[model samples]
Target: MVQNLNPATVQGREYLAIPGPSVVPDRVLRAMHRASPNIYEGALVEMTHELIPDLKRVARTEHDVAIYIGNGHAGWEAAMANVLAAGDEVLVPSSGRFGIGWADMAEGQGIRPRVLDFGSHAPWDMARIAQTLADDKTHQIKAVLAVHVDTSSSYRNDIPALRALLDDLKHPALLMADCIASMGCDRFEMDAWGVDVAITASQKGLMVPPGLAFVFFNDKAAAARAAQPRVSRYWDWAPRVDPDFYAAFFCGTAPTHHLYGLREALDMIHDEGMTRVWDRHAQLARTIWAACERWGSSGAFQMNVPDPHQRSHAVTSLRLQAPDGARLRAWVEAHLGLTLGIGLGMSTADDPKGEGFFRFGHMGHVNGQMIMGLLGGVQTGLTALNISHGSGAIEAAARVLAGR
Candidate 1:
């Protein structure tokens, strides 16, 4: 671990700018810092019931949501278990590591994954996906597992357009979306976009801690569940969404503190309104882009996705000269108390270890000043490390934030 050169400066509250498990708001922390409540029929039970509708609101859906006491991967497993069976085939359109992870999870559960890899830096090729679906004349593909936003590459796939393609081809495959990264940050309309099932976790844009996960599914997905041969009792969504007992919400014991924290987070999201929440993320992303574009003009710095339209508003993937990505991240964290995300699965023939890649997570509970501070820290790191970069990078970022 790199130690802070100035110990006195590292005494303050540290900022976490990684992709998931985003910065938890003070209100959410306060909500969870209490004695565990009664699990049977008191506030916790009623509150859990209330959380379902609010969670659906965030996804812009009026479907059933089953809560689980696990991380995002657990949500993926739960969704897969309910609607899909062993030997079933699903279409996975991969843009980055998260998408590939989901496909791997499906294969582990005895399902076959037909992955249409689009590398780690580009968005999905709509025509290619359409061709794959069109070729499956017998409809062996049960579901199209779509990742709404891949934080590893900071690319946002076009969900609505994919839905349109499926419609045009008259395919019978269910459209399941993995919105673990884009639920509250990006504009996701599960029902409006004709998504059959959607899964997400409490971490990321929900502004809560890791642990709690949710899987929202419509009637079509529920019918698929009914047709399944058998599902694990733990992964079953039937009892979870419509439970006879309160304990069925999360199988047995409840996630006491996480529930309290999630309730508070949902209140904050609704209070701000989804429109402003998305707008804030969009503006912050543009601010980061402005600075990165300036830096890339003169150095080895470059944004992973060339088209801004294909990028995610929650996180930005970048590349510097080999070894510079690692050096700059160390410099900022040690000296300025700011941490950035490591490049995940961005390896190439030249940079096999992905030493030249990094990411900036401008997700939940972030604002203008926080983003400005983040960019300023990076600017300082580049200068201190003697990396060749353009001037006025910070100025470019500030101009975006200032709307100049």
Candidate 2:
């Protein structure tokens, strides 16, 4: 007979500190908790229409947006299918795991991905990118796919700098950005930054569950889509761009509950203001870094990205000795209620398995107290796990929060 082991009861509210699928706000949860609405025509339809404008506002763009009934991967496929066909070549300036993942997705669509691997801990090398584009006299590179803030490495690429490099090289290749991890938490101005296509999902900075993905496109990207040989009906944005009703918006049965949650999430974002939200994420990230810096003095832990300016405000990746990173994560969740992000395979030249790193997310709905709790939980885990760490980590974090 199979034995069923009952899990221990964990007291108090659990903290989800993973990079994406951030803790949903109570208001968004309540909005999603309600019953499914009518799909044909009603308040749901009107509310669904409102999402595009608000989404554009969050992206700080006037370009068009199409909502897909899928996760971030769907947005990736949609962006590629519309602009690229079989045998089309795209330049992927890889800084982290997700950048390579995007290249793999492009390959699935029969598009050739020319990747310039920049390892894991650093930002993109703009000079190399510029040279690559400049060498492509025929402009065989249809687009340059850049990840704005790679959650795996917690490295934030400068999109505007890439745009300037392209302009200087007189490259006509479209600039496509994957803002899945940075959309609401970091500063991204799609149109102003000269991004032709931007992709994001509901999970991360959007402060919602993981069902919906968005693809924002400018006139240039739309023209590229028009020039493509053929795009699958499901991935095509033409019909979904101006839908007649909720079903048409999604190309099938609408994600009614997600829409409700998204509406509430967007409301909260606008109410708090995007600038303020970005500032909060920045401060919390700094606090976490301060704590990690103080802890690193004992030679047990260090931040993945050494330079603070190059790191993402949404997530911070920390490096520790083997087993300690993994053990600390397990210990925190079992003893306390805090859950930290796994060390994704963002390997540097020295550390290949990436078992030495873990990520701390400070995006969406997360506040100062919540961050302090997260840091406190980590400190407890370090002590409980018998991991060697310098003292004053908590004080260091508090000082940062106190702006001393």
Candidate 3:
């Protein structure tokens, strides 16, 4: 590895700009670097009790939350297992990879998914969703699985508007939001938005490693859970949230270090204030968009989502002419120690490998200078690789960061 490495990258700490498993803060790292505590009793148990409310605060929900010892996929399954049994149906309006992945998971579990693919670049068409609900005379759809922010496409769905649509049509379908990417980065009010259930993982916006996942549910979703005849033991949320079954918090021994890391991460988020954390993410996203817009002006650099309102503050997906995206990514990582996210589910007829697409993750534990450095690295790669792009991208990004 050392023989093939660039001198600049060999010394400096590499920055990972992937959508999930974002840069973990030193505080969180320190918190996790500890001896395993007794799961039966003591500070670990007490901290577990405290995490629920803090986690709820991050999701902006005043409902019950179940902590699962798994990733975001586990959270999705956990949420589905509680309210949806085998042969049940769900309405999935997919925008990108993660959305489709959730629906696929449902299908694998014997549940049917009615997917209305809105393409990878666009947000869900409200008219189509409204029409779909109106067309459902018997209300066979048990729940509407909405991905709040698809990390693949970097598009943020309008959860509140979707709730309003369900309300206007008097749809009985429960609203379940997949907030795996948007949890602490975007502004999500579960109660105010009328979302019955929401799922997220410790990775992404929570600024923790990939281990713990959370499923939050309201009274209506709880009723739906009650309606289910039988749910898988490991995926059941009732026991996880029940105070009487403390030992069953994770269906087993518990992820000790992950919980500690999550606790520290939650503390950092609270200390920064949820509103401010969201604001910071939005501003950083704008900074990235600013630079990308400048670069796109003179080249094949195009942002996936055209509308700024629909774009996710957590991540930004971009496309360049075939092979340029891959070239630039390789250049940056090898020379500047900056790793960009690979384009996910953005393939087309011309570019079958999705080599023209790449993504920038600006969520969780990111600051203005860090974003500038990321942009600077990309700019350098663009120049080094002789990729045609508009100039002054770094300046444009800096201006946005400076509030100009």
lDDT of 3 by residue, 271-346 (tens): 9999999999999999999999999989789999999999999999999999988988888888878999999889
Q: How accurate is candidate 1 locally (lDDT)?
A: 0.92
Clashes of each: 0, 0, 0
Count: clashes, candidate 2: 0
Better-scoring candidate (lDDT), 1 or 3: 1
Give a tens-digit lDDT track for model 2, residues 28-100.
9999998778888889888888888999999999989999989999999999989999999999998889999
Residues forming the 10-long window of minimal summed lDDT in candidate 2? 1-10
Q: What residue pairs clash in candidate 3, if any at all?
A: none
Q: Is candidate 1 or 2 superior in lDDT?
A: 1
Please give, for residues 100-175, the per-residue lDDT of candidate 1 as tens digits. Answer: 9999999999999999999997799999999999999999999999999998899999999999999999998999
In model 1, what is the error at residue 344, expressed in angstroms? 1.1
TM-score of 1: 0.98
List the lowest-lDDT window of 10 residues for candidate 1. 1-10
Error of 3 at 130 (Å): 0.7
Taken over the whole model, the C-alpha lDDT of each candidate is 0.92, 0.89, 0.91
Give TM-scores for every candidate, taking all chains together and pairing residue i with residue i.
Answer: 0.98, 0.96, 0.98
RMSD of each: 1.7, 3.3, 2.1
Deviation in Å, model 3, residue 383 alpha carbon: 0.3
Q: Report the Cα lDDT for residue 305, model 3.
A: 95
Cα error, candidate 2, residue 298 (Å): 2.1
